[model samples]
Target: MIENTSSVNRVAVAILIAACLFMLVPLAVAFVTATLDYPTFLRGGVTIIPGTHFFDNVIEVWQLTRLPRQIFNSFVTALGISLGKMFLAFTTAYALVFFRSRYTIFIYAAVLATIMLPLELMIVTLYQVTANIAEPVNWIANIGGLWARYFGDPLGLKLSLLDTYPGIILPQIATGGAILIMVQFMRTLPRDLARAATMDGASPLRFMFDVVLPLSKGPLIALTLFFFVDGWGKFMWPLIAASSPDMITGVVGLTRLDFGEEAAIPNYPLKMTGAFMVSIVPLVIIAVFQRRIVRGLTYMDR
Candidate 1:
């Protein structure tokens, strides 16, 4: 007998194929426009075939904003944010899962509540906070200075994360989604396994390091790929937080590429080239770990 689900499978496959084609339209435009000259792009919305200035446009994009420096800064910021989120999420999940406390659920709920309050809602406050990190540092420094008057010379250190890597990474490092993923995965883990590890004299930290982490490889790989994509694509927070040209990221550079000699005109080809280059990191990560990402995502409750 024929399978009854065959018709549904066909419909689903058809939808997916159509969606892929729909998504490819913009990519096709970007590639076409990336190669075209100013005149061709102005005359036509998007060029159908490649033009010779592809390399020239690519070079112009590189020179415009010191593209290499922006790439380096973006890579640093993205990697740092990804690692920081994963670290915090893992630790938070461990505390919520293996350890039992009266306020445990409340604490987890509080953290999860951040999902509703996105960075856009708090950008102004966060900006003020980042701009004024030096105040607390200076306050502590003053205390040390007073102490040093009676003791040895006071050690003075001025700290402000504004326009710095840590500043960019820290504000964006809140890992609500990652924590949720880890918590779900951990729940699927056998409680007896952790108990046995404990009976064998494994400390909580040891159990996590030796037991939970290894079993978490699937989710870890999945989250890493997901986090890398999100981190690499982060724009607004980095834009406001890192106002200095010296610390500006690749995504931030993308915002500046839309302008030309006048507000009415924009360097479409060059902007497309810059946009294409900016996308390379996430594309590479997705291509390489696409399979692991799929497996890890579906690993929940398994």
Candidate 2:
């Protein structure tokens, strides 16, 4: 029985290794393909063997178009999305967990419902909203502008978020999973902790920032990683919202590269190189913080 069990365990380990490698096939193809020369790439459907044009293809991909600008735009937008989502989720979760009222559960339910309505379904609506988005501060600015014009003092608020970074970030910030995770974590905290903080003269906000959030570092960091990855990987929304080349992200730019051109018939290496580079950041982030993620997701008696 012991020998039989040992053999089964070995087989399972082998199978797991095989499955992991199977999952990496596309990534392997991309990297190997990026190394091949244009001519070799055209002839070889999907080369597993690495070739010699790796650096050359990457350099060409970087220089040939607005790839640098597109990458920069993506980084900025992704950072904004992650920070925005974390802020909104943290505040909302805090409110729901600490300041419970008659309608608190209802509000939580409403927010949770939004997770069901993904970006694809609301794409048209979001596009329309973004197309019309203007800062609310502009209303006050308009009055000030007129007053300044009439009285010879100029006050200005020329802010329109549409087709801009802020516009791209805002619509994507309505996150429900973060709130759910936070609320669940908070519920596990001892009521005596809150009472002790209250007695020690900490205001609700102060307690939240100092106590609750400090205790929640693990979960917050994990969620931040997830949010950053999701934000960086966004393609469809950015594609639809930002038609201008200057406004588009790396994903959109690479996808829209002029594959129609005759030269692009064998330009797979350059394209693959760009794609690998774009994916490298997220992959590195996950690898570095994977342990934190596992800890954060594990339910413990905190």
Candidate 3:
């Protein structure tokens, strides 16, 4: 057994306390700054002294910004993205793990190769595709002027996914990291379970639903929460994809908060308040599922 010395314990406790303080201090400052009114904020400029206008500022932000609607949009987008990623990852990992084929390694390699091509790198091409999903079909139809010869014009078919939920969620769902994690986790399972399920006349789908899926609850929950937070924090893609103000997300909406005219002093206090408000949902989710998150990540039953 490892020795548990008092001095070592004290040092660990001190480090934990320091880490907590490091994280909380900024939050405290933001809260304090958010509580101050415009005049008080202008004069004091981000003080630790708490003011009494927290509710007043909240009301002002609610009225002045489209944050409420954007928050709802964020919820829908994030939830859809999370579920989509989880389903794709789970099914892909399942096939990679359970299906024995000559090309399995090649397929896994191809899937993992996509991690190199992030959304940012190919965003322009993605936007083009999202703008008109049937572009490929149009190209094929107009190849060698085949369509123009018959119809007297090139094939022009437009099926846009822009400004829609599918456009935002579908493109973001192909997560290689989640698939990798699920594959590694599934590899750790007892091989005899699969053999026994086969002997008991259980089909692959039945075994997946009744056996593997049930045991994978921990990892699934962990991945869902992780993806949800990721989807929620996405700014650039959502900003570009969503043309209308009604479809903007919380993060984008937070940035859109007007800090007054170019000549006037920027309203830092109100902006901080909006930041804090936007952060609430994710913070609450992490706090509520703290233990489960730890357990799932570590793959520990305890």
Ranking by lDDT: 3, 1, 2
- Candidate 3 Cα outliers beyond 4 Å, as residue runs: 1-19, 259-263
Which residue pairs in candidate 1 have backbone atoms (N, alpha carbon, C) closer than 3 angstroms, thus clashing? Answer: none
Report the C-alpha lDDT of model 1 over 78-183, residue by residue, as the tens digit.
8888888888888889889988799998999999999998988999888877877666655676684774776666644555678899889998889588899889
- Report, for every candidate in turn, its global Cα lDDT versus the true structure: 0.83, 0.82, 0.89
Local accuracy of candidate 2 as per-residue lDDT tens digits, 12-42:
9999999999989889999999899887877
lDDT score at residue 220, model 3, on the 0-100 scale: 90
Residue pairs with backbone atoms closer than 3 Å in model 2 (clashes): none
Please give each candidate's TM-score.
Answer: 0.85, 0.85, 0.91
Predicted structure 3: lDDT: 0.89
Assess candidate 1 and give its lDDT.
0.83
Sort order, TM-score high to low? 3, 2, 1
Candidate 3 steric clashes: 0
